[model samples]
Target: MTAKKIGVAILFIVGAGVAYAETPSSLITGYTAEAARATPGFAPSAERGQSLFMRKWGVSKTMPSCATCHSDQPTAEGKHVVTSKRIAPLSPAVNPKRFTNLAKVEKWFGRNCKEVVGRECSAAEKADFIQFVSKGSQI
Candidate 1:
C-alpha cells in the first residue's frame, strides 16, 4: 500500500478508538438524565460520590467499596485487593485517559458495582460515583 494510504488507515483507527470516549462532563450529563428519568429532581452530588467511594458496604470483605480498588485517593494507584493487580489512578489530573470511553466506563461500573455493592448501581448512584471520580481525578 502507498505510504499515504497507510498513514490514513492509522489515523482512522486511532480516531475510531477515541470516537466513543466523550468528555467526562458528557458522561456525567448522560448519567444525570438517566437518573432524572428514574427519579425526578435528581442531581449528581460529589459529596454523595465520595461517600459511595469510602463507605464500607460489607458486600465483599476483600473488596468493600470502590476504595478497595480505586483507593480513597483517586490520584494514587491502587492494587486490586482480590487479584493484586496494579490499578491505575482514576484521577484525570494524573491519568488523561480516565472517564473517556462510554462503553468501557459502563462495562467496568456494571462489573465492579455488582461485585462491590452486591447489585448493579442505579443511574443516580452512577452519576454520583462518576462525579466523584471525575472531580477527584482533576485534583
Candidate 2:
C-alpha cells in the first residue's frame, strides 16, 4: 500500500476505535481526581464499590441500597421496589448508555445517595461505585 493510503487507513482505524471506546470506567478518572483532593492518592477498588452497591444503608425503608434498584447483578434489569419503575442495567459492559452523560449521572447520584445512603456520595465513594459498576461487579 502507498504510504499516504496507509496513513488514511490508520486514521480510519483509530477513529473507529475511539467511536466505540466509551466505557463506564472512563468516568472514574474525574471522580478519582476529585477524591485525591480529600484523600490523597485515592484509588478505586472493585470490592469497595461492590460493597457500596450491595450493602443496605437503611436510609430509606423503601430504598435500602443501590441493589434495591440496581440488583446484585449489575447486568440484570431491575425495577424500583416502591414506584415499580423499570431500571436499566447498571454495568457499562452490558449497558452502553450507563454512564455516557456527566450531568445526568451526577444528578442521579446526588438524589439517590441522599435517598439511599442518607448523604451525598463522596468523590471516593462515587469512584468506587463507578469502578464497581464498570467491572459488572465481577470480582
Candidate 3:
C-alpha cells in the first residue's frame, strides 16, 4: 500500500478504537459540560445522583428506583424486577465495562429513566449518575 493509504488506515483504526472506549470520568465531564451550558457553573454531585438512584417514584410498580433493579449496592449484581433477568453490577469499580460505551450508557438511561423517573433524565442527572456509580458510595 502507498504511504498515504497506510496513514489513512492508521487514522481510521485509531479513531474507531477511541470512539467506542469511554471512561466514567470522560463521560461525566461531557455531561457536566452540557449541563453547565444551561445552568452556568453546574457540577455533577454524587449525592444528588444517589438520591435519584434510591428514590422510589412509583412510576413503575415493578421498577420504581434504579436501585430497585440495580440493587442498593452499585457494585453488586442484580436482577430485573419484572423479567427477572440477571443484571450486571452498575459500578465501574466492580464492572470495568459499565460505562465504557457511550451509546450503551445512553440507551440504558433513556429506557430506564423514563420507566423509573417518569421522565427523561437531564444532562446534569446523567453526569450526576455517572459520578455516583463511578464512585460507588465514595461521594
Candidate 4:
C-alpha cells in the first residue's frame, strides 16, 4: 500500500474509535422518566452530585474520591477484587436495573462508600448522587 493510503486508513480507524467512546454524562441521561422523579422532598442535582463524586472525603489516609476508583467519568466497568463480580455500570444507559429498588440502592451505597471512602455516605450525599445519576433521564 502507498504510505499516504496507510496514513488515511489509520486516521479512519482512530476516528471510529473516538466516535465509539460514549461520554459518561450521556450514558447517565438514558434512564426512564419515571426514574428521574424525586421522592418526597429529595431532588437530584447533577451539579451537586458531580461535585460530591469528585470531592475527596473520609479518613485522610484511606479515603479517596469516588473518582479515584470509578474514574472521573464514572463510565469504566470495574471488577470487585474480593467478590469476583463485576461492578455494575453506573450509567443508566448500560444498566437497565440501576434504580429499581431503594433497598438495593442503599445497600450498594453503604458498601461502596465504606469500601472506597472509609465511611458511610450521608443521606444528603446519597440523595445528591442519586439525583445526579438519575438526571436527564428515567432511572
Candidate 5:
C-alpha cells in the first residue's frame, strides 16, 4: 500500500482502539488520579459514594439525593421525581453502558450534582460514585 494509505489505516486502527478503550475501571483510575493530585493519598471509597448517594442535601426539595431518582439500589430501575420519566439502573453490572462513555458520565454528573448536591461533584466524589455503582450496590 502507499504511505498515505498506510497512515490512514494506522489512524483508523488507533482511533477504533481509543473509542472502545473506556471502561468502569479505567474511569475510576482516571478520576482517582485526578482526585489524588488535588488531595494526596486520595482513593475512591464505595462507602463515601453510598453516603453521597443516600444523603439528603435538601438543596432541591424535589431532588434531595441521587437516590431520589436513581433509587437506593443501583441495580433497580427508578423514575424521575418530577418528570416521572423512567430511569434504568445505574450499576454497570446491570447496565453495561452506564459509565463506559466519559462524555456521558460527565454530562450526567454535571447536571445531577448541581441538581442534587447543589454543586459540581469533585473528582474524588466521581471516582467514589463510579466505584460504588460499578460494584452493583452490594456495598
Candidate 6:
C-alpha cells in the first residue's frame, strides 16, 4: 500500500477506537451505585458534598475545585478533554442509577479524587463527600 494510504488507514483505526470508548454516564452510574452502599453515610449530606465539590483541597499547591471541572451543581455534567468523556451528574434525582453499590463508588472516588484533588481521599472525606453529593435527593 502507498504511504498516504497507510496513514489514512491508521487514522481510521484510531478514530474507531475512540468511538468505542465507554460513555461517562454509564461509568458514573456504576460508580455512584458502588459508593452509596460501600461508603457509610453516603446518603446523608448534600451540604457537605456541595462544599467539597466547590472547595479546593491540598495545602500548598491547590488542586482545582470539583466545580472547576464539574460546575457548581453536582448533578450537572462536564467535559474532560484529556479523557474524552463527559462527567456524569451526581444527584440521584438527575441520574436514576446514582446509588446502587459500594465498590463502584469507592473505585471512582479513588480514581477521581486522585485526579482532581491530587490525593486519595480519606474515609471521612469520602463519607462527607458522598453526603455532600447525595444531599437534597431522595436516596
- Using all chains and alpha carbons, the TM-scores for the candidates as numbered come to 0.81, 0.81, 0.84, 0.53, 0.86, 0.55
lDDT of 4 at 33: 23
Across 1-139, the per-residue lDDT of candidate 6 in tens digits comes to: 4343243234334434544432233333333443555574344344655666777765324336766656577677766645657877776557655644444555677677887777776544554565656553322
Q: Give the number of the best model, judged by TM-score.
A: 5
- Taking the candidates one at a time, how many backbone clashes does each contain? 2, 0, 0, 5, 0, 10
**Candidate 3: what lDDT?**
0.80
Off by over 4 Å in 3: 1-20
Compare candidates 1 and 3 on lDDT and give the better one: 3
**Per-residue alpha-carbon lDDT of candidate 4 for residues 1-139, written as tens digits (9 for 90 to 100):** 4343243234334544544433333222322222244344444467777787777776444336666555555455655444555666565555656654444554677777887667766545654675665553322
lDDT of 2 by residue, 45-80 (tens): 889989888888978888898988877899899999
**lDDT scores in order:** 0.75, 0.77, 0.80, 0.53, 0.82, 0.54
lDDT of 5 by residue, 1-139 (tens): 4343243234334535544647888778777876787799998999998999999998999999999998999999999999999999999998998887766777898889999999888878988998999889758
TM-score winner between 3 and 5, please give it: 5
Query: Residue 113 lDDT in model 2?
Result: 90
For lDDT, candidate 1 versus 2, the one ahead is: 2
Best-to-worst order by TM-score is 5, 3, 2, 1, 6, 4
Q: Name the regions of candidate 2 deviating beyond 4 angstroms.
A: 1-23
CA shift of 94, model 4, Å: 1.9
Q: Name the runs in model 1 displaced over 4 angstroms.
A: 1-20, 137-139
Error of 4 at 11 (Å): 54
RMSD, one per candidate, in order: 9.3, 10.5, 8.2, 16.8, 8.2, 13.1
**Pairs that clash in candidate 6:** 33-100, 33-101, 34-101, 34-102, 34-105, 35-105, 38-102, 45-131, 46-135, 49-132
TM-score of 1: 0.81
Candidate 5 worst ten-residue window by lDDT: 4-13
Lowest summed lDDT across 10 adjacent residues in model 6 is found at 22-31
